[model samples]
Target: MKMKLAATAIAAACALPLQASADGEVNIYSYRQAYLLEPLLNAFQEETGIETNVVFAKKGLAERLEREGRNSPADLVMTVDISRINELVERDLVEGIENDTLQNNIPQNLRHPDGKWFALTTRGRLIYASKERVEEGEITTYEQLADEKWDDRICTRSGKHPYNIALFSSMIAHHGEEATEEWLEGLKDNLARKPQGGDRDQIKAIHAGECDIAIGNSYYYGNMLNDENQREAAESVRLVFPNADGRGTHINISGIALTKSAPNRDNAIRLMEFLSEPKAQQIYAEANTEYPANPSVKPSGMVAEWGEINPDDLSLQEIAENRSAAVKMVDRVDYDN
Candidate 1:
């Protein structure tokens, strides 16, 4: 009942005209799902007496903001993936932040150098291997996914997906485009079936015996383990941190940024700082099954059980920069075909 009212309020608020510095309220346009933000927003409201109005969608918030320009009601933008947040800056839709609280909480590697964005939590791009088929220590690196031994044994989503693009971009960053293209072609040759579906679908394919290996985000495995219906499929596979012993696993983030037309700037900043703090960070970590960007806070127990992630130290900006080349390379190699 309480949740319904909150949803009602959020819907009503989203419909009204937005004004700057609307008393005791902050508005947001989020690509992140609403259910994930509800608890965190409610907690912030309870603590500060500031209401949060959110407009959630999977895409187009940036374009909407562009259309509204200065009249945009959004105070903040939150979403997953480096490319999405970088899109905001690339379009000049977000404001640069200079808060000590944000700077202190988020690591340099995880935040934009100019403060155009800050990562709140990170999820690893992991290799999920079939437990019954793939032996322990058999495959240890991202490079191994291209090995001839794994021919006709791999599954993955579309090469154009942001998660995979980031991983591919990282490859270009580390090994140069020529080598990365060769790797992509080899990986494509190894696919058991046409690349389709999200990360979870890749895992499902593995469980159904369509493939012996799949690429997925770490949190998907954790979420599946927690879901009764998905547990069996999830348990059929074991988590492997690709490149853990070398350049470390590729990671992506769920991040937030201040919008240029922040009506209630102060309240938005408060929410940002609150999220970066231990309490909210812990809540986010547990809720999403991601590692907290606030290094001081620990990951949820379920995530910690998976073993530590030795994250690639490569600059995320470099990855974002290489995104075009990565996508082009995906096309050039006919990765999805």
Candidate 2:
């Protein structure tokens, strides 16, 4: 089963530069978009003179690493969401990091317990409510999205999407399975149209009047607002930091991990530490509109304009642990149906 994925992923691996074996170079297998990574990598190279190579793909990376094993040229993996980074740990494809800079930069709750992965930036699972239809303060929490008042007034992407799954997992961590399942069922009952599209689509649905409220990540709002074409759709909605009055907003991360087969271990660690520092964290916040994992680095640009978000204090490890149960609950509710 795994080899099939690896075989298919070879096409992706072929996209990678073959010079990772060379000295003074760090190789990365990234799920992050190249546009977002380019600036950071450029700055890193300019600062340290260490060259970086990346193979960007949406899926099949973990299996690719597992297939390549010791011969793999990948020195590090950069990806978003707790589940993805944790998947590397679960497969034993990555190694635990032992660096003081990494430990000092990322908080305990955002990183793996055994030092296998460290988060770079976080995005809130925000509520995007139609400014015209939905009154301010009408919806304040994830629980409220399931309320009867929102019947046929909500839209979302697939419940199984990693972003939504992380939010659902956090819900499970807070409320347990039975209550969360009930909540999922209620949320499903509230859908305006069958759940469809990505996070940005949910916001666009609100602008189109197909739904009055939707769930999406905080960064998408900023991205849309900054774009020429999507600004109108983005402006139509107000960003709600769900559960700000209670348990706080649920957030997922873009994180990094060191591969077990790191051919450039020292350079990889250098890049990792560099990313954790203020300059790289600032680039992440400004360029990507994401909350920096390092508490010392504050969010900038439109993300900062949204004001401070009281992110849920739940450990990402707990969220990752509960993800399977969350997926099961989504299935039990038949959320995509």
For model 1, the superposed segments whose C-alpha errors exceed 4 Å read 1-21
Instruction: Write the residue-wise lDDT of candidate 2 on 1-337 in tens digits.
Output: 0001111243755654445487878888888866678788889988988887777778888988887889998899999888998899899999997789999999999888889999999999999999999999999989998899999999999999999999999989999899999999999999999988999999999999999999999999999998999999999999999989888999999999999999999999999999999999999778888999999998887788899999998999999999899988888888999
Question: Which 10-residue window in model 2 sums to the lowest lDDT?
Answer: 1-10
For each candidate in turn, the TM-score is: 0.95, 0.96
Query: What is the overall TM-score of model 2 with all chains considered together?
Result: 0.96
lDDT of each: 0.88, 0.89
Give a tens-digit lDDT track for model 1, residues 181-207: 999999999999999999999889999
Error of 2 at 56 (Å): 0.2
